[model samples]
Target chain A: MTTPVLEARQLIKRFGGLVATDNLSMTVNPGELHAVIGPNGAGKTTLIGQLTGAIRPDGGDIFLHGRRITHMPTFRRSRLGLARSFQITSVFSEMTVLENVALAVQAHSGHSFRFWKPALRDPALREAAEQALDFIGLAPRRDEQVGNLSHGEQRQLEMAMALATKPRILLLDEPMAGMSQEETARMVAILGPLKKSVPILLIEHDMDAVFALADRISVLVYGRIIASGSPDAIRINPEVKAAYLGDDDA
Target chain B: MSMNRATAANMVLIALLLALPPLAGLMDGEFYIILVSRALILAIAAVSLNFILGFGGMVSFGQAAFIGIGAYVVGAGTMHAFEDGIEWLGNGYTQLALTVLFSAVAATVIGAISLRTKGVYFIMITLAFGQMLYFVAVGLEIYGGDDGLSLYQRSEMPGLPDLSDDRVLYYFSLGVLLLFLYLSHRVLHSRFGKVLTGCRLNEQRMAALGFPTYRYRLVAFVIAGVMTGIAGFLLANQTDFISPAMMHWTRSGDLIIMIVLGGIGTVFGPVYGALAFLLLEEFLSGIPVTIAGYRIGEYWQLIFGPVLILIILYARGGIYGFLQPRSNGK
Candidate 1:
């Protein structure tokens, strides 16, 4: 099998007395969309935090493209093509939409120590930023401040920023948390074509979007992965249903 | 449209500043020129503080420490020269360059430690460092301690106009202020500025996006320190004296007030702030104050305090913000 784009082995994280992420192990193969589904406070976000280097694991290891990156800083991980979107929409609100994406492009383009030339006037960076905005259908509002964008639009901009970095893998934490049904559909459409190019590790509570897009799904409960397999197999897995789905058709 | 208005206002301010020395000569004589030059020097210091405080959201209360560092470099350099009976230490230009270098190095060390904390802790720690430097200045018996060191002679700069003349010194200070302003403008619009602003807005987000924000912030902090230190070099030349008073905590507080009064983040806001603050102090001090017919002598702060409070309460964007068209978006 092809090497997984991202791999976590026995990841552990604790917050005081509670183990937030307990011995969690997961992988996303190249070109695959792997969804991690769990109830609220089930350590889904914590797991993503560890994967993206925001939260250091108490024990275990993480690898990116078969290279160890367990202790890498968040920025280094991003430079290595491990991009992530926050569960909370985190865009530079004071900056324009294009500026927000341009910053992401600038992050990976080269050292940002260039202090003389105006960043907005840089042709290459501008072109890439414009492309990312165009891809996300936010081109019309490119000059508008990100703070003024709707919650859904801000989510799209967050994704645009992640994509602007040209990551080999994407880690999205609840990208559809506050979106309306139509917005969620639009987001799903946006992610559907993206999976062919970059592997995704999506932590989501929305089962419909997860089942539709996830090539494989991992059911996490109480910080442990109770089951991991194709969506159909997880749908029929009795253990997963009892532990998480609760007899409901997920 | 707002950007154009802001640019026009800035241009007008610059034109006035450039025209000041010649205009002051025609009107009042040397005193006015010296007063305005002092204002300009302090403006540079305020602008430098704005980089870390306004733009980077690092409310460094110890900025006066950098200014003091610059002044002390000049003081120490001159003291060594006087003791050795040398006319000047390779000219004033070399002294100024040394001051800048020392200030940058000092800022790097202070910033590395201060940037580790956030919000109020950062402010307090920086204030502590500033006070520490102030005490050190006071303890330096070789440099006159609290009595302060008096420069027997201003450092000489060959090939350029003599700085001994008040008019020449005023113009030189104005030139340096404008140059630093231009450089700062370029930096604010650059990629480095973007990252600095990004870190200010959301450091975690910037870090997640592949930016080593700590290093970026430290670089910015050092740049600000060096710029302010240059202001200090000018301050020493303007007053011909250096003392621990230069780095006093109240002096740093005054710098913070200058930035806030002008409009914290705007490029030329601090300049306007320094001008307003110094002019207000000058105007207020000249007038006698009375409370309910009881005379209060030279307590200008009583009136200044109320007026500043009113300005802060009503004008959230500061005096610069008050001057701009209200519809202009941030």
Candidate 2:
């Protein structure tokens, strides 16, 4: 009965004629890894966008830590310990990996209005950034530009950037998409321990990864949740099997 | 590994530029002094534009409007003083300060209105606002209409070193420009600057993270305006005149060209660009182009067009771009 870290109630989003996220309602308790699984065009990303304030829902509300945050700006949400790792993996291409994390840490550490102190020389910001990189296993690529990094490394850096904000909840959109099995295994290994501290709302298409990692699974078909339960219950749900996980499992 | 090396190099560069104005006196090159002054003033304006256009991804084409605003403030302040001259610091210093302060306020007001729109709308709206000022300047009968208002007297300082000296003014202007450059660099390296860059790259992502990008962008626009407004103040002092020609869209285009030619988003790039642009103008002005023996003195812009096109085509990185090798890593 603890207050959920993220709670979405009857969220609806539309694009003129198309209903993207239709009547989707969900909740994530603290430290719970909740996976939202749906086929392509099932509005999972749209739902995620609505939750993260990138797109406003037509109807309903989203609350973070029992607070009405649906109308809040993204940075305010992040300042309040809600961080979202982009599905597309956004990072400063011209900057070093360490600089990327350092900037993120700096963004959250205190008032960024300090204009005199050169950011590169700041020890506190650097330490926090270094620690975040260390956690994401990108400490070695600290000086390398994010643009020069491999896709996997960029994804890791994205995670590090998100973690640097020191969030109570992490919203990840398809973290395992377009990754090799080896990369996925590494991500799973890294994420497994982090989930112990922070609640995660993972929207991933990778079923194998989802099955292996997610504590609870929710089935979304064209924006509506068909079922929500423990992994075993979700796998056996008839509505989920018929609507999403068919025989071929595409 | 030490940051001091970069700072040391910058200091050396600053010294070289600082020594140039003094050498103009030794060489008896008043025109050279004038040329460098114009370049520095324009560079100040262009550098300010780079903050919004280069760093913030706001491709503005009406920066000249701010310069125009500054010119008017100076002209109007001086006009007001002529009717009722001053007692203490004289009318001119008060006029100059009024111009700078009012130019900043005007820029803030304009930016508040203009930053609401984005993309092509932003571009067109800024252009429209600049053109609005252009018409207003043209219509003003109190000033000079097509012809700019001439200053009755140069700005005065009430203290030691007497501000009437040309070399003194040059040094003062140079000091101001360097101060601006330092402040600009500080802003770019700030956390606010990083987020601004982030907004440029992916505003949606920045918004999702928690920052209201519109407010940030508006603040950037205002900051850029104030910076450019300072340049405008210097510009009026340099010219000792004010006209509608200052806000013309072509002038704005020239500012854009300066940013691109120097290297957008690079520190001190606009300074190099403004100097190059003015030098090219000077070089072209000296050569009277007579195609098939027909004289063309004012038609030098035609020749400059081809050169700019060549630069755009070959040196995509601009002037600084040409200096730096492209590794294509990013």
Candidate 3:
């Protein structure tokens, strides 16, 4: 059996009196789209943070390809083929689209101590950035300043940046958040093919997209998963319906 | 192809600077050489300050302390050479090497601590360090304490052009500035420069991108310190004096003003800033008019103050920004 691309075993996180993540365990196998659906403040983001090494879990170990990385720093985790897109559209707005992606490519490629030659002129970096931008359908806007891009475009750029790192797994934190319906559809379209190439652990609120795209769905409520199964099983699970899917939405 | 306005302006500026020494010679204005040399030296310091402030997003309010550190290296070297007969310490090359070494150490210590904090806290901490250095200089009785030390001669570079000649000194200062400008251009466009710029714009994003940003910033800080220390070496040689006053917070403020007035992140901005600042000071302070029995020139800052505000308000990117064509607005 192939090892899971990512595995979080009994992760726990607490904030003062509140338990943000409680005994959360999940896995994304190779070539799988695992969608995590939860209500607001169900610790979805906190889970992503712990996986990315931005936050330390109170109890549990995270493994990437069977190698423990629970205590790795954020950057080291990224270098070890873990990439994440923020819940909010976090990007280097002052730079150009290509420049933003190039930086991500630069990060994974090698050390950035090249102090004489112009970074943008490097063919390897430029080509990789272009490919990532093209994959996200943002190649035409490559030279435009990020601040000038539309909100949806910036969200797409975030995906492109994560993609440029050539990660073994992608952690998407509400990639569709704040996107308009058209933009959401565009993002889903981008994700549909992307999941075939890299395993993705997606935290999202849009049910239709999740149901359509997710191979397996995990329904989280109050910082713990109530159900985890194939899309059909999750849709029919009685506990998921009562706790999260609500009869009307289900 | 037509050159852009900023490139054209930069070219013109370089040409004028190159021609200044010869032109001053033609006009027999030896005094102008000294004035312009002093301006160029300060411009070097301002450029180093901008390296961290503009490119790295480190607002170091105590940059003058590096300059003081550098100049004192020169002063201390000369003193030990002449008074104590520690001859090698007086060597210009040795002083330059020591200046680089000492300032790198200072920047590492200061940056390691300051970089942990952001915004106003960073500013305050740097200011505190600068003040500490200033007071330390004041308490050094062997170095003349608060009164300052007088060097008997300019640093003796055995194999190079003599720095004693004002014209030679002007050319030397200009050469150093050009070298730094070239280095700045190379470094800013390089991969390391991109990372540094990224840190300035969005440090969090940079960290997530697999960059250990604190290490990058600390390295930039050290490089900037070394550059400023070199400027201090020249400044001491130029004036033949060093004092605790060089490290005062106000001098550090002047460096920031020069960066802002010229262009914050632009390579040639600080040079323009230093020239504008010194020339304005000379011109405004020379106004012979008396306002109610007080010389107007003595209070030149009153007029200068309003002008700086107007520039900061109206000039979005300082003078260099104005030089660029509108389409390239940051």
Clash count for each candidate, listed in order shown? 1, 6, 0
lDDT value, residue B144 of candidate 1:
97
lDDT tens per residue, model 2, B116-196: 787898899888877887888889888888888986655655663544565666777788778878887887877777777
Task: Give the runs in model 1 whose Cα sits over 4 Å from its true position.
Answer: A247-249, B1-3, B292-297, B325-330
Which digits, one per residue and each the tens of the lDDT, describe model 2 over residues A140-222? 98988777899988988888988988889999999887788898999999888888898899999888889888999998887
lDDT of 1 by residue, A1-250 (tens): 9889999999999999998888889899998999999878899989988888888999999999999999998889988999999999999978989999999999999899889999999999999999999998889999997778899999999999999999999999999999999999999998988999999999888889999999999988889999999999999999988888887667
The lDDT leader among the candidates is 3
Candidate 1, residues B1-330, lDDT tens digits: the string is 345767888889889877887887788767788888899999999999998888899999999999899888888888888787654562698788898888988899999999999999999999999999999999999999999999866768888888878888888988888888888788888999899899889999998899999999999999999999999998988888999999999999999999988888878889999999999988888776577885554788888998889878898888888767534444
Arranged by TM-score with the best first, the candidates are 1, 3, 2
Model 3's CAPRI class is medium
Candidate order by lDDT, decreasing, is 3, 1, 2
Could you list the chain B TM-scores for each candidate? Answer: 0.94, 0.90, 0.98
Best of the two (1, 2) by TM-score: 1
Tens-digit lDDT string for candidate 3 (B188-289): 989999999999988877878899888899999999999998999999989989999988999999999999999998888999999999999999999999
Which residues of candidate 2, in runs, are more than 4 Å off?
B1-16, B86-93, B160-164, B326-330
Q: Score the docking of each candidate (DockQ).
A: 0.83, 0.51, 0.74
| Candidate 3 residue pairs in backbone clash | none
